[model samples]
Target: MPPEHNAGAEHMLVSMLRPLVERGHDVQVWLSRYGKAHRAYEYRGIQVVPLQARLDFGTAARRADVLLSHLECVPSTAALARGYGKPLVVVCHNTHRPSLRDVAAGQTALAVYNSLWMEREAELFFAEYPKAIRPAESLIVRPPVFAGEYATRPGKAVTLINCNREKGGRVLEQLARRMPDAQFLAVKGAYGEQILPALPNVEIVEHVDGAEMRERVYARTRVLLMPSSYESWGRAGVEALASGIPVVAHPTPGLTESLADGGIFVDRNDIDGYEAVLRRLLGSAAEYRLVSKRAKARSAELDPAAELAAWCDAIEQL
Candidate 1:
């Protein structure tokens, strides 16, 4: 998931798809709907072409057997796939109305939901548009994480991976101020303007690759914080769990579902509540160990071997 300039959702998608290359599949990812101009390049074996490139996406997509897309591009991708008379595999990452409405249009041959809650949300959307048809097949295929790759000895720093406003950058800033002596790590995300507050205790780390996260980020992290306003699925939290690092996050549907028993849930707005939880984990060694043990246990439950195999089968079946 080469994360230098990537967000969680795209990173997760790439990680889940990387194994297909090893299995001897010809995988080419096309960025068709971006307004910005960027050069095409290869990540690992996958060739990624941006919308601005001389070779148009429509020409490339025409030659390809199937089309894969998510987010804001779903509606247009559906149209393209329908027009081309090709199968569409739409990855449902969120409950955005237009995207779901587009999925209900019946052009999508396969609907890959990131979580069960998302799958249920899709059902509700189906009810909302009763006349709209459904995809032929739909399944939950969570973003896969290789536990061993992410596992590392947890450190003492309280950390938040992305310091964007919606991801609760201000919440992190307030927490740092509340606890002057406590060390905090704020990692800048690949996208968005990061809120870099002037605080002595809070250390900011520039974005790094997902391969470098274990050593560069998580190695110094004891507690992972995600105070996102919304999260489709908390991949960072799950990655933290792999290393026996306790995650303290806002009770977003994704965090609650993905973290399960591994996370320490705290409302981002409840500053007092967030402070107390942090103090307990940071102060009490026994409490930290207990939570760390739970984190490791949760990570074991989500072994990526089976999930990745299932994902590959679905992709091949498409």
Candidate 2:
């Protein structure tokens, strides 16, 4: 699966829905897979439930005006929408089948692409396969990373949020070894096998929930190191920019589009390049300040106000 479908998708999904709730719309999230226990949880005014929760899906689907979902759950969620004749909004976080499967099948009434690249990928996919069902309408809403909630006084450690191989965990390890004197923070991701290095200068942090990310991680990060081999859109990188935190990242199309001029591009495999960039930031206050200013400016351009308003308006119109 793509890194975009990782926890970032969930965060982006919630960010999109939160606005609906604010605008007096009823919003609920049903967890597709969970332990056998019937349960429900809540976050930022959103009520989340397991499939067998007290408020069962059949009832929810039958009554729901519209269904919004993504990735692994899209298939079953799309089914509920079709069964109830409700509109389906599939948020595309990846170019892969799971994210676009329902969209391709024309099961989705409104398809929300998380990045321009992903939007194009879906377009190309449908164009290549003439028989596929196209979505009636489409829109691009990059993962909303609101600065107010995410911003904090930046701290010192060079941080990498997810330490999985595809997320450039190995690249982080190599960088850590090369720059022994520099401090590095390795954050264990909510999913995937973590490949953390046992280096003295590297402090390993346990996996954290989306709610805890602002305080527990970003507050302590000065630079976000995203060496991911594949990122549909690096939400974490944008989150860091909220606080004027510079990001050194691998040149993925998604990251390139989302971060824009905010990101310092580096080859993930080029440990030396990563080291040079990190060293320059550490050694030159002027360069760091310029990059930091650029990061903040970029974050402002991505303000969720207009994009979120459009998202809410579209969903509400349905």
Candidate 3:
């Protein structure tokens, strides 16, 4: 099932669905109450089902041939498959184990870490669990971005991204004050709106469709500013790179893996270091050009269709 407010999962679901439908496989989406009908309604030749029942596995399983669960929380579907002799495939979006507190209380176990970084984190957290109760068929399949419009000549526009409370809005406020000439566009909510008073350069935008978001934000963005406290895949970083733009991110756990070699990573606490890197990149056209080229190259390296095919192969093997 899809999360209520996650664009990353929406992109992944659509990416997987398109290919599966083309290959003559039936596709269905089990979504939460909050999930938008726009995507499910917009798809061509696919069955989109909204699930209203809470953990009604027997009911959901009987409607479909194979079940592809989006997150570990939906392992109830896996349990259903076990009971009904149906095939179950679970997708891992992040690698961080639920906090120790959650595990100690005997919560769900299956998960998919989007990067090698997250997979390692998960393995360490589940060290105490017996091999049998732990994630048995989890694998990393980094999220993909659909390539859309991008700036032919990126100007001084720098994107400041943070959707939730933990996304380091304070750091961005400081940067906005220092870099008065730079423009900022962020995914806005009540949590992010509070920062706008301190950040005049930043524009708060409503969550938009991925393709539209790419054209409006990613296309013109010269650098994607990722000061995230915790990011599983750095969706903004990957999207910016796919748009031929470089990223400047804090060296947070999941952000580091997503921006590796594709962009710059500054120590999270080193405010001075972050500023210096941004200034250096902006000042040097040659360095910016090189990094920009590499960013786009890296984005193209992860093919969504290819990744989904690989995931399908793994599921088939099981």
lDDT of 1 at 285: 94
- Residues 68-173 of candidate 2 have per-residue lDDT tens digits of 8787778888888888899999888888865665687778888999888998899888888888899888888999987988899988898998899999899888
In terms of lDDT, model 3 sits at: 0.63
Which prediction has the highest lDDT against the true structure?
2
Q: How many backbone clashes does every candidate have? A: 0, 0, 1
Model 3 per-residue lDDT tens digits across residues 148-180: 533344656766654554666666667767888
Candidate 2 lDDT for residue 269: 81
lDDT of 1 by residue, 1-318 (tens): 243356777777787768988898888877755544477777867877766665577776788787888877788878888888889988888878877887888788988888889999999988877888999988788878889998999987999888989898998899999999999999989777899778999998988777788999999998998999899898889999999999999999988999999888988899889899999999999999999999999999888777778878888887
Model 3 error, position 87 (Å):
2.7
TM-score of each: 0.94, 0.95, 0.80
lDDT of each: 0.85, 0.86, 0.63
Off by over 4 Å in 3: 1-6, 35-40, 44-46, 51-58, 99-112, 131-136, 148-155, 189-194, 316-318
Regions more than 4 Å wrong, model 2: 1-6, 35-38
178 Cα displacement, candidate 1 (Å): 1.4
